[model samples]
Target: MTPRPLPTSPAPHRVVALLRPPQAPFPLACATEVFGDHGPAIPARYAFELCTEHPGPVRTGAGYDMVVTTGLEALERADTVLVPGWHQPPGTEAPPAVVAAIRAAHRGGARVVGLCSGAFLLAAAGLLDGRRAATHWARAAELATRFPQVRVDPAVLYVDHGDVATSAGSAAGVDLCLHLVSSDQGAAYAMRVARQLVMPPHREGCQLQYAELPTSGPVADSLAPLLEWLSGRLDQPVSVAEMAVRSQVSARTLTRRFSEQLGISPGRWLLDRRIAATRALLEETDLSVETIAGRVGLSSAVNLRRRFHEALRTTPAAYRRAFRAERAG
Candidate 1:
């Protein structure tokens, strides 16, 4: 099959999720929410659809059934072909018919995505050869054992290679899907979609899955107030001690709270906020780097550039130019 270009038709780009039973619901839900209809306020850039190998009532492992009306033929028109979390018995290969369809679809030019254990299907299809793929951490070893040709990095959230992509389990699927939207649509638009989903700008795809995350225990209260305070003070240099004082807690206690609730020290959180502010300013304003540095509480433009590169691997000027196009489009 000759590979074609990405979808550029006047119609909305089509996203088709390929499902097999017993299907996991969370990864499917991630794709649906990110690509599904968003009402009149947001222009539809993509059309979300579903298909199955057998095309009938499929058991959702989460205790429900979804009736898929389309068969694998859906792959033919898909701008992006996605396989949501796959859950066959361990060491069991994805059905040969499904594997052939995915391989053919990719060869025919549809971008292929595997979320979570769906990487198993892509591996079976041989799309992951010579590529670093990500899957749920628990299954990483199994995937490596089965497909030594594929470099399996079980730590990252997702990996996108333009033509093919895979994500770690669960919510990381949301990150990869949003990354696609940011690529196909734009960052400004992806930000709007993120707002609708009530999620942070989907984490960077390469972010480690084992990185510290917010804790569920009620050992510490929510940090909403402190975050809000810090957001308003991004223009000023506020030390961690000052933040602790404002929170009415000792610095030691504040540090502990940050670790328990946010999985990072108060200082890291503050610096992240500054970096985020710097990005927003760079993307939205015509301000010079020196001005943006002062606004985000950095000592100099050089410091801002170094930190920006460390975070995103891009300079502020280049990012601004790139996202300016994203925003304008």
Candidate 2:
């Protein structure tokens, strides 16, 4: 039988997820739930499917089997190709055919994605070489050791390279998928999907997988009240001097405490919090950049843009457009 031609129009993007033996079901389900067709109230934005290398029953790590009919040929028609999680035994390389198929799909203009340990597959395919990528923090060191060419970032939730993307651990896959939806359709649609999934509309890809909370001890305990105060005053101009005064400690002592407990200097910690606040405001509200800057204590829009771009590698305007719902005429 003759195969139908792939859609040329960009709407309803085609997503082909690659499945391999011993698949981890959670990440696979994350991709499916985000890209799968919902009922008519929310129009279908993605045509999602699963494809295996050999086209048959694929074993999952969750002790179940999924029958896959499509093969690599499905990738030929995909706008995006996702690898949820590769076969376990973290060091094993993906089959040569699977690697080649992924490379071919990328070459043919599909945006390739890897979730969790699936990043090993993209690295093996040469897609992540010389590029920043993320995987489960536990396997990040091994990915770096095995590949050597990929710049592995174990801290961030995900890394998107326009043509290729990778996410850390199981749930981070949902963040990456929602990002894809926002990129392809718009933030409005992505938020709809997120609402259905009962998830935050967007999580900046750069958010730390695990926040650096202050370690417990006398010094950390003493500074807990000051930290709570700082959290509430993010919209005001704050300084290490003020913090030290509030904590009744010398500047040097406060600096030492911040470094020992939070693994960051006081100023750096404040800046990180401001940036995080800016991102939340950008995603959830329609506030102007100037207002957001003031709200986050960055003070000026110009400085906010500079710091935001320096930190996230993208401008606040672009970030807002990517995650904010568009207004109707």
Q: Provide the overall lDDT of each model, using Cα atoms, as 2-decimal numbers.
A: 0.84, 0.85
The TM-score values for the models, in the order shown, are 0.62, 0.62
When superposed on Cα atoms, how far off is each prediction in RMSD?
Answer: 10.9, 8.8
> Taking the tens digit of each residue's C-alpha lDDT, what string does model 2 give over 185-229?
778788878988888899889876652322223545877898788
| lDDT (tens digit, per residue) of candidate 1 on 1-329 | 52332333368989999998889999999999999988766788898999999988999888889999999999988989998988768657678888888878898999999999999889889999999999998788789998899999877899999999999998899999999999998787888888889887757876666422222234344566777788788878888889888888899988888887766898787777777788778767899999999989887999999987766666888778767765665
Which segments of model 1 are wrong by more than 4 Å? 1-9, 211-329
Residue pairs with backbone atoms closer than 3 Å in model 1 (clashes): none
Candidate 2, backbone clash total: 0
Q: How far is 64's C-alpha from truth in model 2 (Å)?
A: 1.1
